[model samples]
Target: MRTALAAGTAWLLATGLTAAGAAPAQAAPLQAAPAADAAPLLDAGSADGRRFRATGRLVGGGGTTCSATVVHAGGRPDPAAKALVLSNGHCADDTMGTNDVVTDKAAPEGWTFTPAFFHDNVAEQKTFTMERVLYATMKDIDVSLLRLNATYGDLAKLDVTPKTLADRRPAPGTALRAVHAPSDGIEDGRRHLRQSRCTATAAVPALHEHTWLWKDATRTDCLGISGGSSGGAVTTAGDTGRLVGMLNTIATPGYLGCGLGRPCEGSAEGLVVPKDDTAYVTPVDAVASCLTGSGFDLRRTGCRLDRGTQVTVTPDGRQTRSTTPDGPARWDVRITPGQGTRPTWVAVKSGPFGAVDCTRPEGYGTPRRLPAAGLEHTAVLPAQDNLHVLCVAGGPDATLQGAAWAASLAHPAYAYVRVDNTPPTVAPRIDAQHFGEGDDATYWVRPVYAPWELTGYQVKYGPRAGTDCADPAGYRPYLNIPASLKASQGPWTYCAIGSDNAGNTTAPAAFTVPSG
Candidate 1:
């Protein structure tokens, strides 16, 4: 059977099968049912929020439970180099006991995972079975990596677009989000993802924290985490969406409220003093370190060192304004190596026009030596054209896919001048919304995007109130309320259009504003 341990400062080294000691009382399972009047949606519309549904239970004998998250490595979500689920090592114990893989203990029989079960909006929970565990260990790190079964073809089709792993250490004071599905009871586990907003308190925590890339964090709000959340994800707050760490355990002064079958909403009374009483995480680098030596071929190829490298390009001066076609724009490129590395190559992508070979002189390809450190290179680009620049630097031996490289790297920088000849796609969403003024009717119009082509928005309304619905004619400048803005009153049909600087127009987004 699974064991629990009290919250303490003593380290539990992942070196061997230490005898199962007294475990902490299992926290109450999370309350998974939302109020009957609650919205039908389970997520908050954020990337990680939507992806939380993919977190599921690791079911062992007698219905023991733990949590795990699905991840797709590399920047791109689809067609990734590695896709795997990660969780605590104890979740896959072969004997249904707290066993360590470093001690040569295999995972218990019937060890399996089911994604998106319980609270999946149906009368009953439905789950898709995951395949075998590729790696599991308690020694030095409490982690388990599992592969999805072959029967589930195409992870993308399964609606399991994995999240990209975080590569860099988050700056202190950065806000973060952690999501998990905690077990509610020994009889039945909680099936919905619970989230807590936390702040990074420290970069290197104490040894008992049980991770090399340890980051001590505390919930910013009253969101308490409970049991069964082991192996869930911890991510940053911005749209860049870097995955920072994995949930391990909590160190609370006392039992927080919202336990077993209760909403894991943290309470002020439950908040403890003492620094040790908080949540702990295993950094994402641990996963990379483990997978690289596992011989599973899961090690991500391309430039690992290059992923953290920073690149920046700036216009020489006064170049921010729109320019006439075929205008000249001058810019400078700067490259800064991430952490312990430096640049090796720089390539420029001049949109809709010129091509420069990276290997040749002034290019980033090999045989061309990089300039001295802290030096800036200047380039003159055409006006009204989009430009993309890449700067790569690493040891001479680093290579990717037969391309000689000491490491892989990200695009250095991209600049746009907003010249478009093609019409923009129509905005897909337009809705009449209510914001409780009782007598004010408002409509929100979304934008149709093709990256940097948008220049202006126009809204056309009919002559009479409440009748100008969805028509293409009689359009006027919609300077009053911007897209997603709310207006006081409207009983009129409205159609919205977008334009690009290059004289291209988008199809309309139309809706009839109901009389408030």
Candidate 2:
């Protein structure tokens, strides 16, 4: 279903004006040749900009069309699985349920992917049929990872190399470039695939925590992610072409064929009051987690087996207990010598106690390892009952640290655990009850700060009559928060729920808007 939104409220808002630096040459508009005509974007910047080609257009039997990208995920040395296809879950399959899809779980009939679909050069393009579905879902994350029947050699002629999947998640303000096929709807008839430079605007305001909105680099025009652009690869702006997310949906129409603040081209109904320059994007990390969890071996670029490094956790001291039963349990932890600088803090995962969630706590500071000495560290476990120490270690970052735990040694040389059944810490309060003016009305809710990782949140609002605000499916699926809502001259009740990365949602925090 189309993401729910308040009537007459314009949710699509472009936040950037300058093109993302280092993005591939400006994308050729549909039907229009690129100005530079630089070397084709071949092999993910392997052979200069002239030879870069990793994006493709996907067409299905039921008239469902979108874009696709070839990604490298497994067997880094030789790439166990070289050409895994990544796209939006809704592109291949249209079935969407309350939490997920229903049936007929394969790519729709006649579904095919054409890589290097540049300049409409039919002979130079290579087409591949989807062979298997590695992992796909629409409920929580709108991503689909699939295996194609074509080999690396098939794409090699098109000068296409599998793009690398980013290991990290994206935050607001992250610069991005969407390499996509803006079909007739999104584009103004330009034929070739285009690269629209944009930046992530928010993580969880209108839609789910996993879905984010991005503003186009151009201030005057919309990002214009139309039908054919669905499932296109959205990569970082640098030369690596590392996959960060994929085009899911336009979500809302920003303008009715008119530039921002200008007269309507056709009808005023097409305008999103504030003019939405954003599109819905499903993150690559979510796709990777789902694909890997489903027994697929996706290869990652520059991550060969021999080159992979294991982090070593060295315990500074034996576990120490508090004299009082309800006090904090503590142990010191430090990465082994020669590894590098000391990690700010140790991430712990206890089976009996619970998982250490850190999704929402982006940029939040970690408690120092030592009470006095910053160099020496300590693993502080919450004082509770039935908590068993599972694993602890350090890595490049918090997200990577969690990934490192998977490869950690069982009963590692040094590790500690403690119990604290307290639900995740709630935020100080809802950031705001209202934002924007008139048609641009918005509601703001900051993420609840906590030591644990936070995954996402649920937002609900409606007349106080008989609304079941607790039901996520019942709540409006507005991801473009603050911007997607309009202020009304009425007393409307709203609620915000916080969730840890582990999917633990907080009790509803409610507020009401006073009638104007």
Candidate 3:
């Protein structure tokens, strides 16, 4: 999960910050620092809290919070320039698609950051508005480089310092510490910076979490990490610690399989789910080469990050395309090439539903090469059953083969097609209720039972029985009828058809009024 620290009434009550009927105060704007008297104080015993004055609580446009840090490429930077803040890409925009890459975009309104966000000195914190998103992407990495409206000189006046980005990835077993402003477990309900002592466990070649697949991630045993910890600074342990990575996610407990909160490590052998309490960090070394004196420039010499346009694989017609066993089990999809993208290779792989790894080439057959630049190209998946995933990857050399082809592929576009001939076996049941009497009598019918795989149901009602129950065009969506419908519509006959995730539907089950 991206760890969107939620702020709600329940959290206020749990923290005893608000009384039963008292209204919470509205958050102040980030134009200036809050009054010292108006801020909450923290424990004075801990001295380590003062070290991470650059780390702060980042509030998204949607009101959710995450951790972020002020960072500079290296040595001395111009203090007059607008400061740069680093955080997870999802923090900048959680709605980013699998291959979405956002660059040089205007920051959403209401986005702010509070530096010097220590539990001990909450009163000293200053909020600043985000001016722009220099670069933000979740492709092969989860990172965002944001520019603040305030200048480094402005922050320096308040004794706020920026952490230096480490030039390389930290080796396994390196002593490390994580500093973050997490919202969970805070008795006061305030987002306060917390620190954890840990060590780098291992390097994950690829970490698969839901639709995002991150490469070269560092796994750690960091404790005290929770909601609002996304983009927390993971640095080498010391007084002058340098930033090595940023906390991205944790292995959430209770998830039985790999997905979302439960990020699985992928390798040639397959995926491995880590035990609960495990956390992962994305290395920041790649960002170093991209940073310039002004800000980030993707065209920089040594920057290996993908700056090419995104490839799109869209189905010809309906977004959801399905086929039955007896029907032609093939789909026609259009591969649209983005401007500036290189020649692309398209391939299709199929497996049991939800088993295919769209990022890997282990099970993929051969790939068909597409021209360097084209408006669109059509690719057909070889006839197969189960689920098919069509992937399109771009690279430098169009004729690259074998390992070179797999290695050169970057930020591939994917589309899915599901094939299943089995229709839902179970029938649907309806519950009917009557209210009032005689002329004022009203009847309401609701579906009470549906198959486990049911996605939705089509229902039709009239004075007579329905004909051609399988015709979905004749029915409306299955919704609870209002009690206002007159029961005098008497002897009404209702028919229901259910559709499953595989696009297969069950035969209509009918119920007659008064007789049902």
> What TM-score goes with each of the models?
0.41, 0.43, 0.65
Local distance difference test values of all predictions, in order: 0.42, 0.44, 0.64
Q: Model 2 off-target regions past 4 Å?
A: 1-52, 74-82, 101-108, 186-189, 205-222, 254-275, 290-516
**In model 1, where do residues sit more than 4 Å from their true spots?**
1-41, 44-48, 75-83, 94-108, 117-120, 123-126, 151-154, 185-190, 209-222, 252-277, 289-516
- Ordered from best to worst TM-score, the candidate numbers read 3, 2, 1
lDDT of candidate 2 over 391-457, digit per residue (tens): 4433344453354433332112223332224344553134445667776776554323221222245
Deviation (Å) of 21 in candidate 3? 36
Residue-level lDDT tens digits of model 3 in 331-427: 6666655665554665545443235455565666565665544434334443433334455664444343564455435446655443445576556
List all candidate RMSDs to the true structure.
21.9, 17.4, 9.9
Task: Give the Å error, residue 315, model 2.
Answer: 49
The best candidate in terms of TM-score: 3
TM-score of 3: 0.65
What are the per-model numbers of colliding residue pairs? Answer: 30, 39, 0
Count: clashes, candidate 2: 39
Q: Where is the poorest 10-residue window by lDDT in model 1? A: 258-267
Clashes of 3: 0
**TM-score-superior candidate, 2 or 3:** 3
